[model samples]
Target: MTFENAVLKLVSGQINRVSQPATLRTEEKAVAGEAASQTPFSEEALFEYHLYTLENPATLKNNQAKQISLMSADSVPIEKKLIYDSSRNEINSIFHQFQSV
Candidate 1:
């Protein structure tokens, strides 16, 4: 193509980029505005998130060490008990190090 045609094509691309209208619908724009205006998580939502973390095996096992039933049921789903035991020991040691500090 001619140099003039190449220049025109570049100019057209720039205009297209600059003049493109926003694509969000009115409802979507409102939702986007609301999300921008509010905190991502309220205190209640944060607390619930924390409660969820507490329900996981890592937390439950740490908190219920004295309970025989919990100890028995605390086994991971892995078929290899040796690997599980080694990893559990390592995790417990790391946990203890953190607790000590």
Candidate 2:
């Protein structure tokens, strides 16, 4: 898959880095909801983790950080959960789940 005008962000164990801004272009299409007579076509933006090869080597200096974007999605469905274990402790944990279409 090729992405145009796509921004990338690198995330590792405790360190995060932002890659250079690029362009992304896709030919993928999505079908809209049922209409009275005709069906309309809409552009859907799909974001996924992908490996990208850099044209040139990038270097980072100490204490220097760069900002990069990983992915962007619209109208994403999310579920939030709160759990408490009386046997374990009195601490409550919060969990968030994101569903991708």
Candidate 3:
């Protein structure tokens, strides 16, 4: 199964399991209330959850660059240096896999 389908299946399965109880309720209102209280999941909400961003893109980039800089120290000077540079094309290539066809 695809990643999204797998995730939805896991989540929905959990919800389904939690929703059904072994003990039965006597009151009709109580049963109705319990059913009404259950949360309904939507595709939009699931997609948004997957796409949610915690930090600004610029801030994330800055933090990544800072982390890379922190890994290197002035005392540890080397003759040869290795750099990892990413271009727009590379970023697009990575992101393109998730885009809808």
Candidate 4:
């Protein structure tokens, strides 16, 4: 509560805030380097199927694709998003039962 203590706290917070970005960047680089060091091939290089699998030009279903579509925008590649055709359509009614919970 004293002015000296308050000023020291503020300075400490500011120093931490300034260094936080560098700390985060360093941590990210460290993890990436560690992961890279273990493997002769990265995901892009090792897994040709993951990198080069062809997707259908046409979107088959609207409702089921929503979550997959949104999450697909992120850098992480999802394997489950690649789906085959199915004619079933009870999801809206099935999903409605869980609304109260």
lDDT of 3 by residue, 50-71 (tens): 2222121223332233221111
lDDT of 4: 0.30
CA-lDDT, candidates in order: 0.30, 0.42, 0.29, 0.30
Shift in Å, residue 75, candidate 3: 61
lDDT winner between 2 and 3, please give it: 2
Residue 80 in model 4: lDDT: 31
Local accuracy of candidate 4 as per-residue lDDT tens digits, 1-101 = 11221111001123335454535355445545554444333233333232322122333343433211211112322233323334663332321111110
Per-residue CA lDDT of candidate 2, range 1-101, in tens? 33444333332332354975443223111211212113122222335433333323345555656443232345756789889889988658897765434
TM-score for each of the candidates:
0.20, 0.31, 0.15, 0.18
Better of 1 and 3 by lDDT: 1
Which pairs of residues have clashing backbones in candidate 2?
3-24, 4-23, 4-24, 4-25, 5-22, 5-23, 5-24, 6-22, 18-67, 18-68
Which clashing pairs does model 3 show? none
Indicate the TM-score of model 3: 0.15
Q: What's model 2's overall lDDT?
A: 0.42
Each model's backbone clash number: 0, 10, 0, 0
In model 1, what is the error at residue 3, expressed in angstroms? 48
Once fitted onto the true fold, the runs of candidate 4 whose alpha carbons sit more than 4 angstroms away are 1-24, 40-101
Candidates 3 and 4 compared: the better one by TM-score is 4
lDDT pick, better of 2 and 4: 2
